[model samples]
Target: MSELRRFLEQLTAAPSAEALWDLHCSKMAEYGFDRIIYGFSHYMSETSMGDPEDFILLTNHDPSYMELFIGNGLYRDAPMVRWALHNVGACSWRFLWDEMARGALTEREKQIIAINQRHNVTAGYSISFKAITSRSKGAIALTAREGMTQAEADEIWAEHGSDIVLMNNVAHLKIVTLPHQSTGRSLTKRQREALEWVGDGKTTQDIAMLMGLTSATVEKHLRLARESLSVETTAQAVLKAAFQNQMFIVDGIQG
Candidate 1:
């Protein structure tokens, strides 16, 4: 319990999502879990998970494998992912295959399983976090070290399951509060201020007067902000920046 508390303290100090993922990977490795893929969806519905753009996916898997698994949409039928989409709480991957005997898995699911096995991704546990909103949920899948059979993996988890669950949940909680480079947007201070004014319902002329800039310069800042955020309009830029948690942030949101 003390160790978990210390880890939580360290977790909150992570400077960015990438740093958090790195710490999480090393921490999970200490418990014989060597790989993980964590995902958080901000916009979801009963029918869909909303735009892929609205989700955060972090993994240490090989790029080639992810190209096929995620890039190709094969994750749609991945048993653990499917489980997370529908449920909250942790479950063993062993339960995923129980459906095979019951003939509940689709042909596509079977193929994905076979592919996973070839990659030594056979044993793992899925933890689907409690939803923060009706349309938002997050989850993580922890894969045991290669060469460990399900029995061996289960043995390790049995001994440390409580700590693992608590640590991971705390990590997720800390992670969501950090800023993400979603959309790869890096707004300059001026661009950010421009968007902030726009977000506060200011027009170009108003922002120009407030910032002591010409109307043309204010428009330029707004245009650059839009391009940096990959949006077509100033309003969209503000919304996207807010979504990435890059707007309206006070200094030291993270310690």
Candidate 2:
């Protein structure tokens, strides 16, 4: 297997969230991207589903370029941020620029692009993923030197899809490691099943019918979910469960 494949296999075998994050960072450095950043919202707190705040921000750029990025808050108006908000999958810099050209861009955005070009950061690729916690999301971006071609971008995406997914998963794990309740009452099998259904956007009535329970019974289970997660509403319960890695939605599981 290729190194990327081996790394992914290792990630699959990782026994803890910390181990997974370390593996992801090491493998990402091996992929030769100039920079990578993963961010999550405030949802992941205590469960076993994934971490929302845990992120890995890596860069191989010169110290000066890094300094410039932070000094100007370029990340605030970055094209990658736009791409992550609008696109849910993988894409490249050329395509990103092409899309930007077709959209209305502020002078600040244009200036950021100009700065990137001046620094020879002419090409980039990103694979964005939806955050299971909160309403926030994130992506992993890889940038290349000037004159890089679309073929190279595609090659990187094809070669590194699994690594990108693994990185995101580990990031989720880290978000759940915040100092708080480390151990709580374990979720019952039925609670776990119901939580997964809720995460998939199922209505209580629908879940009741699917599980062959009364709608009131469904509500009772959801009430338990809310109390167990210490959240006020079902939505908060679902989001909290997701962020804390307490519940894994069947549909959201990636290979």
Q: What TM-score fits each model?
A: 0.90, 0.51
Give the alpha carbon lDDT tens digit for every residue of 1-255 in model 2. 886566557766665544565666566655555455445445233332133223233345577876676544686677766667666776777765676678867778788889978887767677677655454565666665456666675677678756665665555445444222223544555776788899898998989988999999888888887777766988887766665566763433311
lDDT of candidate 1 over 220-249, digit per residue (tens) = 988988888777977778877776777777
Instruction: Write down the lDDT of every candidate, Cα atoms only.
Output: 0.83, 0.62
Using lDDT as the measure, which candidate wins? 1
Stretches of candidate 1 exceeding 4 Å from the true structure = 250-255
Q: What is candidate 2's TM-score against the reference?
A: 0.51
